[model samples]
Target: MHGFAARDDVVRSGAPEDDDTVLRILVVEDDEGDAVLVREHLQDGGLPHETVWVRTVDDALSHLAASDCVLLDLGLPDAMGLGALQRVLAAGAPPVVVLTGLSDTDAGVEAVAAGAQDYLVKGDVGPDLLARAVRYAVQRRRLEDTGRALYQSLVRAAETTRLERALLPTPAVRDPRLEVRVGYRAGRDGLLGGDFYDVVERPDGTVLVMVGDVCGHGPDEAALGATLRTAWRTLVLAGIGADEILELLERVLAAERARPEIFTTVSMLAVHPDRRTADLYLAGHPVPLRLGPPSALLPAGQRGRALGIPVGGGWPAERLELGDRWRLLFYTDGLLEATVGDGTQRLGKAGLLEVADRTLRGDVETDGAVRPDEDPVVGMLLSGVRARHGGDLVDDAAVVLVGWGG
Candidate 1:
């Protein structure tokens, strides 16, 4: 190697002594004479630059790993012709500019097809062309990197939306004796949170429904929520009762949860269609309010702790008869956590019931059908909470209203 020292390393560009931004180039060439010739041309071109020469394919790869632009001589002693070009391109960001001997412009063209940004005929090119080529390759690589980053961002955003939609529950029981509705609002605009719900109708006509909130916001929380909802649905379909399903779900919560601090508050309801009786299982969650002949919060008995963070023993499922045309409002804490005033006091369960009473009793139209007391029940809950909070709630909110149309 003529004056050309072989070093496996990256070349970092420094501002020229004259204060101009200089382009950095990694030259992959085995011949010292050729490397010097290329550098002379680039320096002579009045363009500021520093070239780091690597002689072998392995050395070039190491340099590629560290650097961004490559001025690659197609024919090298260790890796010859287009093979050298391909290896460099595959390594990373540096767009390649092929260096070719006079008779080998064809090879240079072929190298470009294999992903080289441009080619230079060695003996025929001057300093201006050499400098311009390296600068152009750098600009090209920058654009390509920007585009790749943007595309990945778009893909990630779409996945988050899909994951969110998958985790959300759709009402399953359309009993003439029940009116079922659901509401969900993500606290952060364009962000996914850990709220989830699912309603499944078993072969025996028992409706198994659940609503839960994993303890955070973002993709990880959303993903775990989706996993938990899916597991719950599968367990219900497998004919598991509420207690057994909760135990199994706790196992999943332990295994699939991304963080140890993460936990879930869930409520599962099993409605027996024939007898019109519903079994309620609480797992450290907000209780469901039974809006019966007189709309009110059905008592949420003291029971199980949050899943994964077990307090002690298991929960005994409670059974209740579904009154004719009853509406069950199941919600996440975000609904009640909304502030009732500028003070530290929260809406709490009792405060929420008060709002529900006022709104449900007032003429509110929901689903376009306004019974004397049948206002937009779900809307009132969300809007009323926000009005009291001074704005939207600080956390993600979700709601499910199961109305049995007697």
Candidate 2:
């Protein structure tokens, strides 16, 4: 192969670009004479490169990942013509430049269409041309990869916007007297989860609030939550009572769920305009927390099975007198179930209540008081839960707090 043969007095492109980046290149050529020429061209081109020569396609496949680019010879014993190019590409080879014979220009053109970055005539390739081909091939392939990733990210962003709108909707109350606040945070990975909520104040000045979780996480669970939320808003707009609305919601969940094991926990309320009472419907969910005035978490009633459970029915309303001035909070389990200390125990309901007390009434026993600038808000409660978790919560948390008066 004359690998150490006399240096060919190579011709330069007159433009000596200084590039110190060493490229790792794979040469798949059975002919030793041609392999020597490829090596000489790149070595003489003044391009920093690590060249590896292989005699067959099988050897090339092993080093595909390690190589930044590949120079493939079309006329190989085992791999003939376009078949060699097809095989390399099928094995997920890197950017490739095919070496064809003088008269095989037609095959070279066909190779580019078959995914080769570029093709060169075996005898006519020069030091400059060969080096440029390798560099451009790698650069072009990298651009294509970046473009594909960006397109996929744009698609995901659009889908997320649609799902978020459905999951969190505008309040329907016209009454200025009632104040409502809500916040939602996804689980650990920042990927959206199944927790969702919706609030609508009815025409009679009665306020409706619901917070629920569709079992599991990801786009599918998120989609189901959005679907259920839309249905809840529709039922509320139609003036369905709290219990019947829940029953209908259960049927919708069972029908729409992708798997039989999938179920949903929900807490719904119908608060009267008088700002003094509400009808609560609980389904395997945490009891509502009342932070101010005449109430707190009292045993409401027999909590029914969550929607999609096999043997559950009769969703009934448990009435409550919320008093004239009250602050009521409803949330998904993500807030209370987060891990607290050494991970052996979870910051269950009691832990959350401790934080909630500090967030509102500035109880200094635990994490000190909420600063004067920070008003008592549900978002603060969510932040407090995340702090108690020691980081991001392991589950999606959704919260809605409603207040009637001072």
Candidate 3:
């Protein structure tokens, strides 16, 4: 028949005349004499505290959140022994110190093992000892909470790192004459962003490269980018034509996208085995930069609509006569959209080219063997972009530089 009490039901005492550091203590005991003794102990300790005397476990549960520490009795009318302690804990009661009778000393030990911050015998406890135990219990509980939070943060960090590695993969170029450099960084150094790129060399000696961006940021967009990138690689390896590859990729995007409004932009280009000419195809994507003796933005002629557009369109190729000593810089929009230092002007195509030029280029040695991690040009370019923006870019950024030394 016992139940929650009215707000004014609990007998309150032990609060100081004036102070904010007063600890609120909830004393859960059915015996009227023991409750009075506990309140007297709290007052005698000379500590600024507020004590709420409750008669049952039910009443204690109602006051759990308002109390800084719980002084619980092992025996209660509605609950017995550890039953009282377990219910208090399950109700999310704050730091708890179980009170026990002399015959129940073993029960007190068991209660501490179960989760009580500390335990005290009823008759033997003094005012100073009770005060010290309550303070210790509160401090210990806070440390445990902090430890739990730190552990959860570490788990999230590990997951983010794994996603970052998945989003930035190495190119699969087989030609010694072909040099590929790449870079990727998540926006705000937060969760992985929706930017992905890849390269593959065909059996016929031609190289196919691609860079793509999903419409939004965060984990969903990042996962979508991975899906599109993987599908593109599969289509290319299966010998699909560039045009058909994009069309099929659109279907993939449309099917896997998290929402109907979501879309993707892509740049797919094919470099002939001879390394003298290439065919570029853009679908609502940024134009690649032609880094020759004079670096310039390659023309994205009659661009096709971005993949997953409602009406749907095809991605046509733009033939490029990239003579000897040429490099192509392909990127997601994040690189060019950075706001200039304290201004509204964005670091657009021109700014990107300027950054590329100023950045120290670490090309492959004569041996044409540089590890993907060893490619430093892309990293420098990214650093330049961040410097220009005065901070990290607000969107996920990715860049790929394909070169041929004719």
Candidate 4:
């Protein structure tokens, strides 16, 4: 019944001086004599380590979790050969250095392929060899862990990009007289944010435009925003009335929301192909800016509460006389919430109109002959906001511009 020498009595030969960083080793060997020899070899080696000895695979599993490395014996009392090694590895054991007999060295090699980090024959291993094997195994395991983490990060980034593309889709309008332009900027939050917008020209010669913001910023909210936008597009395409569309959207938001507290602020506009009238609906959203003969914010009387709010209500659609020429701008609250200068004062709705007017004053010629590739007024407005903020906006921003008979 050989046993480990007392820590005070064990002579430290060439072993490195103990420091704060000590490598912990779990020795899973059935024979007490073999375990004593292995501990003596590591103590005499120049590496600082603390060893925990266990006689069976069951006992070893308990100590495996906190150990930095494992010195596992293939021939345990209850387990034998690679079966023992496979069980320890499957239990999420740390880096393993399999201990093998002279005849079973081939089995040790197989264990290495089966996920053990390294292997050493009992009779051939010296103090230095044992320490070196343990050190190398720990380092290799850390490198593999790091590589796995980086690969997972790349996969997440690719998925985020795909979701963002779906959230902000291209306008589905073919009318030459009607111009639709959109600009989007994701906030510092992440690749995907809660902002979304969509434009669609119906079969009956009517254009449906919407801009919305879910309550929070993250993957869940971004995904919810995309779902709502798709639902809106489907409803409009199916010839749902403007009033009925918002009611259905409210039900969808309530059902799909991750939490009851989450809500969405949205602005919707329906423009007739005759270019004589437009209907506006505001649900706890900002008033749209109309660049008429005189630039002003369009009045939608008595704005309704945002969707998903506990309070029940209906949003009334206000119809406006579009006259002959009009350019309308719809945006999320992030545009008006941008901070100005070094203070907390927001740019607000008035500031946004001024920015649009200033940009339009210089680009009158380009505005006369609009091309799909040319910069739209919404892009210019976003640029002004970014310049004022000194960089990206604090929250996700989305804007859609619709022009008819311009």
Model 3 Cα lDDT, one tens digit per residue, 318-387: 9998888788999999988899967689999888877776663533122222235655677767877877
Scored by lDDT, model 2 comes in at 0.82
- Candidate 4, poorest ten consecutive residues by summed lDDT: 6-15
Candidate 4 segments exceeding 4 Å error? 1-68, 75-91, 106-110, 126-136, 292-295, 361-380
* Model 3 steric clash pairs: none
**lDDT scores for all predictions?**
0.76, 0.82, 0.84, 0.83
How many backbone collisions does model 4 have? 0
Q: Candidates 1 and 2: which is better by TM-score?
A: 2
Ranking by TM-score: 2, 3, 4, 1
Residue 133 error for model 3, in Å? 3.0
Alpha-carbon TM-score of each model against the true structure: 0.70, 0.84, 0.83, 0.79
Evaluation by lDDT, superior candidate among 2 and 3: 3
Give per-model CA RMSD.
6.2, 5.8, 5.5, 5.4
Give the range where candidate 3 is weakest over 10 consecutive residues by summed lDDT. 362-371
Question: By lDDT, is 1 or 4 better?
Answer: 4
Candidate 4 Cα lDDT to native: 0.83
Per-candidate clashes, comma-separated: 11, 0, 0, 0
